[model samples]
Target: MNPLRILLLCHSFNSLSQRLFAELRAHGHTLSVELDIADSVTEEAVALFRPDLVLAPFLKRRIPPTVWQRVTCLVVHPGPPGDQGPSALDWAVWRGEPHWGVTVLQANGDFDAGPVWAHASFDMRPATKGSLYRREVTQAAWRATLAAVQRFAGGERSAPALPDDAPLVRWQPLLRQSERAIHWATESTTSVLAKLRSGDGQPGVLDTLWGQACYLGDAHPASAAAMAEFSDAEPGAMLAVREGALLRCTVDGGVWIGQARRADPPDTHPTQRSFKQVAAELFATEAAGLPQRPVPLQRSPDEWGELRYTEHGPEGARVGCLGFDFYNGAMSTARCERLRAALLQVRERPTKVLLLLGGEGFFSNGIDLNSIEAAAHRPGDSAADASWRNIQAMNDVALAVLQTTDRLTVSVLRGNAGAGGAFLALAADQVWAHGSVVLNPHYKNMGNLYGSEYWTYLLPRRLGDAGAKALMTQRLPLLAAEALKIGLLDHNDEGSRQGFEERSLERALALASSYNQSGELAAKQARREQDEAHRPLALYREQELARMHRNFYGFDPSYHVARHHFVHKQPHAWTPRHLAVHRP
Candidate 1:
């Protein structure tokens, strides 16, 4: 092919544009680079080059019509053909789009409203905005531009003409701090999870805890029952450490428990309880407050207790606020069993609504892993199986809560929600959290697998499969407000316990009273539909798992190594990527 003259126009001489310029020049073409897209500069550059093709690889500003008309100017947009403009990668990642592409189009007066010349598409991975643009789009642009130049030189320009009725150009504005605020009450674990993953390894999901700007990272979605089983403190309180894990609370009365940083100095206050400890205490207290009733266990009837409920007239009954102390709780299997039994009793109630308002400063922090370890280490005959059974029991309990239909449960949270605590909130029909609350699912940081069953179904239902995988596998967290935007919570309001309780109860009652008791039926129908849709995929997954286990079960040193690394290492020692690899 004959050497062709090319004019390379860029908004700035940034790294990306510079690389493109180098590539073009290396191709033995007569190339001139213009660092500005200003009308006069672009016109002058186009005139001087008199090139066969004018290419723009990374120009942010608009190019004048004079310059485009003067030469065969082509713009390379870093997104799919339809998804043009700034923040393209951000939107793509946020939406969890399957594919991303680079679009080479004829430059026109209107920005990104050009006729398509050539396009290259690729699958989008769980990538950050910077990574997607830097790696995928940048490379695609390089390859596409080179090919386009060759085609133009050969007079094979098969550029598709822009239709008059094409969709209007769309743009996403830069993310603002205010827009990133976490709204606890109405935000769901899935919604918050997406936001956290969207902001992974960056400044992270933004939030103001007690009016202090806090950048959150390393979050994931877990089951409320799992969180409850793992934590032993009030929702916001720092409970005791089991092995190396630390537990906290979610907006709802669930547990948020995970590993604590070894680098950070330990709190000297003996009164401090880890999230698991506090959650166990709250669970016990709530269970004890319940009205005694005969409930059937596996094969026998046991006198189970129900949470305190008060009638609200035709509106429905309101469960009394469950008090929780962020600082005190006993961690034991018996406690977990009791808490589970109590919650089950509450679920069995014939009432239409149940509002679980945690104490002034906290909610349930989840279960006690220390107690779990202690039980496992006991000279028992089957410690491993027993431990696994405990986890299964927790999963079953969480699933029960998720499947509950008789009561429209509302978890009104006021503090930190971590791990299973966050999942507990997920099980509820509605969840509310104060602005001061912080929600985290730090499961990977803990040594155990993310055993919560609710996540398997709830996450995919709320945020799609890709989003759910990213959130759970990546271990990210979401602030309250961001949670709201993503549809995690039903309603959110910033205020005191009484104020939040009043609002949450009103909303829950409205929902419970208005709709006929068809939620359970509807849920079953939805489950059936999803099951039908995913049957093939589920079978494939099961097959894959079986094959993986067969291949690596006994000899998988990687699993042990990962467990050791996570259990022994400090929180700040690893990045988000490292933590995600080990998350169950």
Candidate 2:
């Protein structure tokens, strides 16, 4: 097949766009990206690129009719053939649909009424819109998009019509606060969670906190302990706090609100944390007054919790699983420290083998940009200080994993991993991932961050000097299979998440049982000693931090500027030149 000149149009070069960019490029497609900040700019980009076809992977605004009429433009909608509108996933989640799909259609004047090119569906799980979009929606969209693109590449002019059984196609408007509003006085825990999660990462539920209106987000159903403790509280009353989340009573159960922000509050001070912040951090007085409902030692899927420790496999050859499921996988400075403590605790256990099971939807996306941005608004706070501390805390966790010499360690990624989180997994003796998982292992995107977490020592060791250089400069998402082929991943569980978990534990146990435990430990210690003798880990960390210090405190404010825009959700000014191949 001939390579097609394709232009990628999106509201922002988000996760979906990045994934598409990497995949299409790998398949020999000439691609360019342009942010749809305005219709005029988009038209100019279209004229400049003169693409054979324009693919709208994710777009908020309508494509200019002038271009869409002249060139075949495919819009990737998050919902099925009949599904139309901006809040496709949000509505499906709110309505509790059992199945959902992605549809690619040629752009028409009426939004989503265009002829369907191709579509793919997936079974739905109860999850935040963010989670669904990243997992099932992404995969389905890729398949449908590939089909549509192939058809275009094959000189096909027409597409198939929507099936008769397609759901009632109608106009669906953007979800507003009223649509997501929660009636705490009457809502159940499940209902409350659905509403919050339907819009988790954006436009949080409008609710009141401490007499001030705030947007509540990242809701989790209260734990068993909290349920028992607040067994009879008022439905709307806040029972207590676990971690940074606020446990508020529901009709039959309670839900935990992890973060909140003021809704269009006056922007008076530069340091007022008006953005989304940890509930406890935002309401310190209220949180301090209530007792902490700490996470339980036992693992229970019923209750919502972040970190859990469990032992798997036979009694004689047990493998300890230390799981940390941070919301959206953004480890704040405190989360890194807490996870470090948990890792240290797991090391003391008598289990012979260990696995670091990160979250289900996302293993990690590196430091929490939102939290660090909030620090910029803190009284006497600076983003530089926050970045320094957060990266160091992440380093503390990585160092703990690197320094471990007793038990054999492994990292099992069930979902996507990026930046320092990807390297943190590499700190383990072995790294394994499910076939569906995607990884972005470089830090240059975050304002050329000279990442810590011993990535300097780890990545090069896995991919060599030239490969490491390519990885940093390319900044493309790699599938688990690709990562394994490049020596970044040690094992691949080419199956379901459940299947991967079961088999990964079995493999870890087998490795522990087959290998000489004493010899493994000794060899590990010897290798560490050898590496230290040549180039100490401290030297690597110091050199990395020296570069990072300049990034934080130097004359350039690119890091801070990028972070500010990210947290604020500012529209993109321009597409990156690397992805926008049309640009010089």
Q: Top model by lDDT, which number?
A: 2
Global lDDT of model 2:
0.85
Model 1: per-residue Cα lDDT at residue 451:
38
Looking at candidate 2, what is the lDDT of residue 526? 92
lDDT of 2 by residue, 1-584 (tens): 67999999998877788778777877789888888878887788888999999999998789988889989999999999887888998888888889989999999898888899999999988888888888889888888999998888888988966667777886678888898888878888788888988988876788898787899888877766558866678888877888798888888888888889876657655544367888888888777888787776455767776788998767657789988888778899999988998988888788888899999888888888888987876789988999999999988989999998787899999888999999999999999999778899988877878788888899899999999889888876787878999999999888765577888888888976774776887888899899999999999999999999999999988888877877777667787777676767
Tens-digit per-residue lDDT, 1-584, candidate 1: 66787766765443356456555655677666666635675676566557788788876677777877767888888776765666566567667788878888888776676778777777786644544554466667776777677778778655756567744566667655455555665665455545555554343555533233345433434445434543554434333322122233445532232211111125633222221222223233333432322222222111111123333426353442332222112213444455466566655555666665543333544544434433433465332343444444545545556556555667777554555556656766667776434455435534434435355555566668886667667444455555666666666575532366567667766666665646654775576567658653345334533433332233544433443342232123222333122112
Runs of candidate 1 exceeding 4 Å displacement:
1-332, 356-367, 381-386, 448-450, 496-498, 515-584
Report residue 58 deviation for candidate 2 (angstroms). 1.0
Candidate 2: segments with Cα more than 4 A from true spot? 266-273, 515-521
TM-score to true structure, per model: 0.40, 0.95
> 123 in model 2: Cα distance from truth in Å?
1.8
